[model samples]
Target chain A: MIIDVSDPADPRLADFVGLRDAQLRRSEDRFIAEGLKIIERAFAAGAPPRSLLLQPRWLDGVLPLLTRFPDVPVYVGTEAMIEEVSGFHVHRGALGSFDRPAEATWEALLGARRLLVCEEIVDHANIGAIMRVAAGLGWDGVLVSPGSADPLYRRAIKSSMGASLELPWRRMGGAADLARLREAGFTVVASTISPRAVDVDAFEAPEKVALLLGTEGAGLSREWLAAAGAHVRIPMTDRVDSLNVATAAAILAHSLRQRG
Target chain B: MIIDVSDPADPRLADFVGLRDAQLRRSEDRFIAEGLKIIERAFAAGAPPRSLLLQPRWLDGVLPLLTRFPDVPVYVGTEAMIEEVSGFHVHRGALGSFDRPAEATWEALLGARRLLVCEEIVDHANIGAIMRVAAGLGWDGVLVSPGSADPLYRRAIKSSMGASLELPWRRMGGAADLARLREAGFTVVASTISPRAVDVDAFEAPEKVALLLGTEGAGLSREWLAAAGAHVRIPMTDRVDSLNVATAAAILAHSLRQRG
Candidate 1:
């Protein structure tokens, strides 16, 4: 249903309020998809939209997608109203409130051949970029540690360019989960900068592999590093110590990806 | 020299005012380096420090580095005062104003073996990440198009982990510079998603290589692509359209980096 809303404080626009406030968004089960492209991606991924608030200009572009769910409300408002409600200039004046999908099951991830396991990666943008590269390179799924950033967060979704909507991922329980990956016939490899770590190029990809990435500053925790079956490091000049987590993810994902 | 300034508007603090204002900073012949780490990197790179504005709490940590530049003024102030002057919460209450070094001469870059050529990548953080990866992977230098973001910008330098301070880079006059690179015996390879582009893994690296990267939203411009001696692409599944420019740079830099 299409509903025209004039007041920024209208209770109908509650889903769109305080969009820029991360803490407020975190407590809710719903996630916001920004811009027309990501909204379309969310729709294509079969995410159910609770409501949409967009300018009249975008109505025609979004009409076709709304056909699937005739009951979901589409709140039409002015760009100024959206900025007022959301506390930020809504990108292209389009935003979709969607029920965050349930994360992939551990069984589903274990059955996959390639998986990126992130440990305490707290940056939303970094996690999003990791998901984008992981999906682009055809990795089967991803497992983020309990302390990692939410891939479904707006900034993360935007950074992933909507890959978070398509990629199969779940929040891992804890460090003990490394044993579960190994038990499922996957070689757990830690990406670290330790001097004794095997060079990425020199390290052979096992038939099934789970690449472990760590937090931005500290890298993988010592407990997580010790649990891995193998440790791999990207060779680099001593001039710099490490690559950004996402940048390292791309290079490692490309180099160690399962080949036909 | 130590100066304790109470007022944010002190003329002596002019070099540090409006540090968050990019436009104001762009027109000057100097750049701000944030945090003690980046400030140290700037010092290690031998960039002359014009002045230092930092909290008194960090005085002991910065004292050792100042011994070398005894003539440089070190202004001690409260974090609130530094924040008031810089227009942002200065990271760790440490900031340095340094003379932006001169661009590396064309002669210096032309002699390098492995070079990353950026084409209008206007995001400061993206350019910074590109520089960080290029430096980490041992690329000899970088060549940015006339329209690319300033690699010396504070955000760029911080995103690069100070690689922008150490990596030798220069802006090209225009597309005609590609010919100069070719003349220097470097293969001008464009990183494109064009269907006909050779898979990066399959393409053999030339003796000397200059890999071209494009802007964020759009890929490489046609004129630049047409002028390239070769086109290469990282093979990826069709799920995502392309990798982030910085992510692409890291993979390409690693795969095609000059090796013994």
Candidate 2:
């Protein structure tokens, strides 16, 4: 179904209305996948597309993929009209709304050997980068705390390069969730900058590991740190306070990932 | 030298005009530091302050520092006034213009053991993050290609958490500059995603290392990669295309930094 949309107020474009409004997007069930690359990744990851709003020039690029989803509406509009509907300049002139996939089940996450557990990391870019690092490094899954930014957020998905769509991840409830990982034979490792923590290079990773990363400003909560089976810190010079959470995740994830 | 300015167009505020305009800022001799922390970092790094524009409330916090630079102008104003002059909402109600520090001398950089070499990495935040990772991990200095983003750009400095101020970095003319690192006893290591590249963990870093980072979209130019003494890659699953350049820098920097 190819629809020509000239009016930005068209009700059919509801999923993309105010795309830049994070709060509004959170209240909706659909997540917008921006750019042709992310859209293709979303499709490849088996995410069902609700509809697509894109400039006519991108039609040839996405036409093959649309053949598989004959029922999904494909709205073609001028660049200005599309930007008006989204409330922002849509990058590369393509966007797709997909049904937000269900979170990975606890049973699946528990069986995993390597996992990243994030606590209150509110930055969508950080959360997305963590997911990308986790997935790229062959980590089994990610478990984000309740307060953490949604990995499915448009910006997060874009930042993750669509890794969030393909990776297995679930929302974690609270500090008590540490017990669940422990019961599943995971040694919960807390990443801290405190000198008291064991240096990451010297610490031996266990057979099953769940690395705990904290927020951007203050590190992991004392309660969360106490619950960990071990504490690991990346040694750094005193010139700076700490590494960005995403940067830290990349270093930690690469170091502790299962090696052949 | 405390001064009150209600008008955004005051002639005295020329250095602070359009702080958000990268092109305009690049043409000027001064760079803006957004937050009080970055401003303080700029001062501590021994970079002379040209001027300070901040809200009235932050006066107490920066007063101690201003005492040291008695000749430097301090302009206090409403947040709205500051935002109007900057063309953006200045973060944290504070901003500073600092004399852009000179590039590190080749003699100084030649003495360093660990270095990050960036090639045309144009994103300001990536350049900033790379600087932060290099500084935090205790790298001696950074060498960026002439086309790379300015490490002293306001957004770069903010993303770096002022690491750009603290780290010693220089710009290189072209691919011929690889010979300079070689002559300085650095084994230039090119980072790539190819399977043919040596695994980062398995590869033994040379005594003096200059790790090469490429642009955001492309990995590295053929000439640069071919010029490298060795190629190393952080082993990753094939699911994702590549890590963000800064994230890759963190993993490679920590892995290759001199260990005690």
Give me the candidate number with maximum TM-score: 2
Cα error, residue B37 of model 1, in Å, equals 1.7
Per-model DockQ against the true two-chain complex: 0.83, 0.89
Q: Chain A alone, TM-score for each of the models?
A: 0.96, 0.97
Per-residue error for A12 in candidate 2, Å, reads 1.4
Binned by DockQ into CAPRI classes (incorrect, acceptable, medium, high), candidate 1 is high
RMSD of each: 2.2, 1.6
Interface RMSD of each: 0.7, 0.7
lDDT of each: 0.91, 0.91
lDDT for predicted candidate 1 compared with the true structure: 0.91
- Candidate 2 per-residue lDDT, tens place, B154-210, comes to 999999999999999998989999999999899999999989999988889889999
